[model samples]
Target: MEFKKFKLFEQMKPTIRKEFIFLLFAALITGGCRKIFDLPKEKDYLSNNINFSNKIFEPILGRTNLMGGFNADNSTMPMKFEIVNARFGDGRPVTDLFQKAPTYVWTTAYNGLEKSLEEIEAKRKLEEHALFEIRSSGEFIMWASANNSLIKPRPADSTNFPQDTRYFDLKITNSGGQTVIKDLQVRPWRERPYEPSNDMNLYTGGPAPDPDFPNNPNTRDYIRPFMSNVIGDATDVNLGTNDDENDVIVYIRPFTGGNGHSLRFKVLNKDSVAINPAAFNETKWDKLVHGFNMQKTTEYVQYDVAYPIPLVEVPTAYAPGGSRAHAELKYSRIGFGGGRVVATFGIDFAIYKKGDWEIVFHFKKDNPKFQND
Candidate 1:
């Protein structure tokens, strides 16, 4: 029996050796295949320290809002950003946000140095885009078309019901790797197309408030002016009694009746009567703004030109920097002893929404003392 077992083992030895050799050759080919199809490993990676300056967004409807606050800790520049899993609090998809619609986007870089509306128009082009998206620069954009009705509603008292806001995730990627920022919040409010909002809330779209723009005027008043500077000394006499800010209030009102886009400036007195534009003798109506076809009348000074006062925010011939539309009204009045006091009432203002707006300067104290003492 032992001899027969030995004979069986001897017979199986050649078959077992052949099987081992075949397996060894298969392993060699498998190892060579890896070398034959070598692939390079990714070198770049997403930084764990990535963060955003502003995580929450509350953009008003009726205008394009570019909400950008990305802080790439150690990540590579020009990183790609994509919005994914945009939905309501209940996990329902926000389909309209992803759908492309008509939008006015700036193609040319706005250095704030453009002189005319023609130059501004050359930069801006009306194109189709998603209601909400992340741009290549990691800036989040909420298009004008993302009206209040399409988004998740924010109740009048949403402090108690915070879940009414929209939620979205961001997928930031590079050639190396990608990371998703989850559960970003957005609460789109109703559209208040213009500023000094009558009903809608006035919000600082950025993280910090501009020190220059201390406060937004009440809806009733566009700007309440004070004595910025007195050219000459007339302290002994009450020089027009411009003591209070409400002494002179400017009202910015948009109107439809005009040849085309226009802006009209007028002055009013305490009695709500129109002050003659001729009273401001020193004010060069032609150079006061970038508007053309100046029409000076007893009631108001109308200009038939661009919709926005300062085509660009920069300090060109019209506005100062910071995208604000600035205008200074200058007039001289004789003080006691025939001394002239050139008082200047200056206002730094901005109008983002396009319209034929009228600025009415109401003198609450008294009609600007244009009479010689």
Candidate 2:
């Protein structure tokens, strides 16, 4: 009986070993081997979570932060983020032309907001990739224009399709191949004009003389703001469509070798020329700003605003009679900003020959309505 039992135990050992081998093969096929080997598992750490400060608001004309306080997480993996598509809440597409990182119209506040090509280039060197870098950390920016970009959508014009309230979506992806989509909405930039009751004039090509001149003891200080009103017209045109030469005209009183107001202007068009006027009207002045006026052929008209010393009250120290300050219009286009090209209208003026010159009025693209100070 002992011999029989030993033989039976030997047979059972072979069967048990075979069963163990079969179980190991099943574990391998079912990914149990990954646990056995303790290999690092690919992690999906991306989540569909995001936050923005303002869900609905107007995008400032130039470059502005459309949304703030953005939050997201990509745990254990590097991720990439971008605006997958932009559109209006109305379903109209906001083209890629508006999405490319924009170059700023470097400005200093004076009459309005001065647009400086010289400063644009200078600031561009300092500003390269700064605004775009914000996207990596998670924020959405927009270049809003009722009428400035090659892109056809304008915030104004109620007859048009996309009137206001622009919308867009963001796409985020992680290294482990997970994706999430987020949505954003911004009020499109619109015209905000000041009312007449506020003692401001919309027709600022040339404003009325100060009402409180003598009554106000400090007339020089008081009148400066009112006289500092900008007088000009600007628009964002589509030049590529018709491909015609457009003119930007800035009316100026020439620098006729005196303590008189000296005018200097520049442009960013196909060609530019400065013509000194033989005379200018002191009393009834026209409000046409010296800059690009988009013709029917041109699709977009971009204008800049710069305030010069108020045309009122010339200094007592000038030559009695030089050129009776006639309207001389100067126009030029040296270069353009990369994104949402807005030509900041700027002019440097001097009381004397290139001395003590300063920017008078700066017309900001963002402040199109030309609000009163």
Candidate 3:
């Protein structure tokens, strides 16, 4: 009787243990399901559903011309000029301005000329003998202007004329199907007026002369002007020009290093631009030029004059998920002569320990008129 009782007790213990284990497992499963279901749909799956990533909308290659001309029909006039030469920040030719790379330079030439013949004639005379010229033999010319009337013309004989004429001796050579120039100039036009026609309230338009700030630890005070206006608040508010299918290639490089840096890219939209308290206000149209963040490095960095730095180090792990970095790009009718928009974007990178990372930022066209096939 004692043995039978012991055996029965042992049997009951095993059954109880099995039941406890099964109950625990069931509870875990139920809890897991509940937690999963309770999670916010947007938080758990929105990113996957949205498919937001830094995608290369357009990869520009080879020598391309960023041309600009007089457009009297829309009352637009050229305001700035630039001659960019491509080289790695380390002074190596990753591409050439005249041979490869996108046109990523900006300058000012005239303002208040996009209104009437009187304005154009007045500005033209001032421009022709303005003593400022951007002459380059190798670099392509990409002229941009603002439509503001407040911009005053530089003195006809001002010795301090803002001109970028370093293109006379510019040389571009191709090796391995890439441009390799030892020395090149990355200068923009200096003397020009500002127009305020297409300026947004969130941006202060002007040339971005400094590309090392905000990314280089050694240098600070990198203020990216909202627009390319060198005059009063009323400045040239027009976006740059780009023919359909012609992607704007922006080359991003570390202030010191040559290559192998990760870049972060982002695209802004009309709502993002308008609501950005760090950029625009409601009263005036702010021409918020793009911004970039990069890792501070001690290497010599350069850019390919041919491939304008499209948001640098695009499609990386550090990219802002969901939403492109160039969705806010829209052509400014106020100055777009051949149907182009003044768009803005930003970039960020990190240059720490070897094999570190860098980033880039800019706007991109959703339905760019390019051929994939």
Candidate 4:
């Protein structure tokens, strides 16, 4: 029996060794492997309550805060009453006062309160209410005895009388539920107008009989104005359909000699479209440039040049009287252009003589067409 047991032990020994080697190889191959459980669920940071409140009431509350505030006097007494602890049918508080109250309520509640505080402060400082009574001819006067304690009585013929008074008709309700209907008036306190020594009418061009231009007569001659072509020979240039050509003209008119004489001109299209600054490209012959030189000669001659293509700038200059003429300008194009350019040109002449200056201008229409957009 002992011999048989030994022989069985010997047989099982190899089998056991084989199993140990297989287990060792398997452990080496899967040594770093790990089992993964589900990660903890992520938490949401934003709550629904905060989002709902912002969407509904934030904007309304912001406007209410701006529209209603303490009066200018910093008084705790609110000019307008806000109903607290109030709710709508849905149990939401009333945050908007502008929509709930009438239109006049806004001005009366806010503006009226401000004005009342200002008036009170002014009366306290200057010892007078700047209140003025209205007269039949739209004039105003500060009543002497009415504000006597706060203000001294003015003479019956005080020159500083109020000239223009703006009155606002309003009805106000206080927090205490007291209603007051009143007319608020603003007084205009402006300086006196300087009266001229001589009568000068702007409608008719003439000199005033003052010391500056004494005995100076109106030398301006109203002539039949003609559109003179100064640059290119385009007496009958046909601009293609939906296109335009520019021509410059110098208008010469006589006037009393003065300093700082100059002219300003503006062109308007046929459809009453003002020539926007872009049509004068350097490559286009349709655009024109103009200049005037009085120092070179008494003649107010205008030099006009037409560009074969549209240009960005035009070179030009002008002078004042015959002695020291000093004026300059550069014309440039702006905006897209299409067929047919109809323009109205305007000129304003400014001339100074004997310490006096005069201004005049001519209004004329010019229409020229081109072929493309």
Give per-residue lDDT, candidate 3, residue 198.
19
lDDT per residue, candidate 2, 172-240, as tens digits?
666656454545655533221111111222222223223545255332111111122122334433221
1 versus 2: better TM-score goes to: 1
Clashes of each: 1, 42, 100, 37
Ranking 2 against 4 by TM-score, winner? 2
Q: On residues 181-266, what C-alpha lDDT tens digit does candidate 3 reach at each position?
A: 23333333222111111111112233232233434445322212132211111223223223322122232223343353322222
Question: What is the total number of backbone clashes in candidate 2?
Answer: 42
| Per-model root-mean-square deviation over C-alphas | 13.0, 20.9, 27.5, 28.3
| Best model number under lDDT | 1
Per-residue lDDT value at 263 in model 3: 29
Q: Which stretches of candidate 2 lie above 4 Å from their native place?
A: 1-38, 42-44, 63-66, 73-78, 96-123, 126-134, 143-164, 176-179, 190-373
Question: What's the true lDDT of residue 112 in model 3?
Answer: 17
TM-scores vs. true structure, each candidate: 0.72, 0.34, 0.17, 0.17
> Which residue runs does candidate 3 get wrong by more than 4 Å?
1-65, 71-220, 223-261, 264-373
lDDT per residue, candidate 4, 161-254, as tens digits?
A: 3222222322223333333223332222111111111233222223223334445664222312122211111323422211122233223222
Sort by lDDT, top down from the best: 1, 2, 3, 4
Question: Which candidate should be chosen as best, given TM-score against the real structure?
Answer: 1
TM-score (C-alpha) between model 2 and the true structure: 0.34
TM-score of model 1 vs. true structure = 0.72
Stretches of candidate 1 off by over 4 Å are 1-39, 107-120, 144-153, 156-160, 196-222, 229-245, 305-315
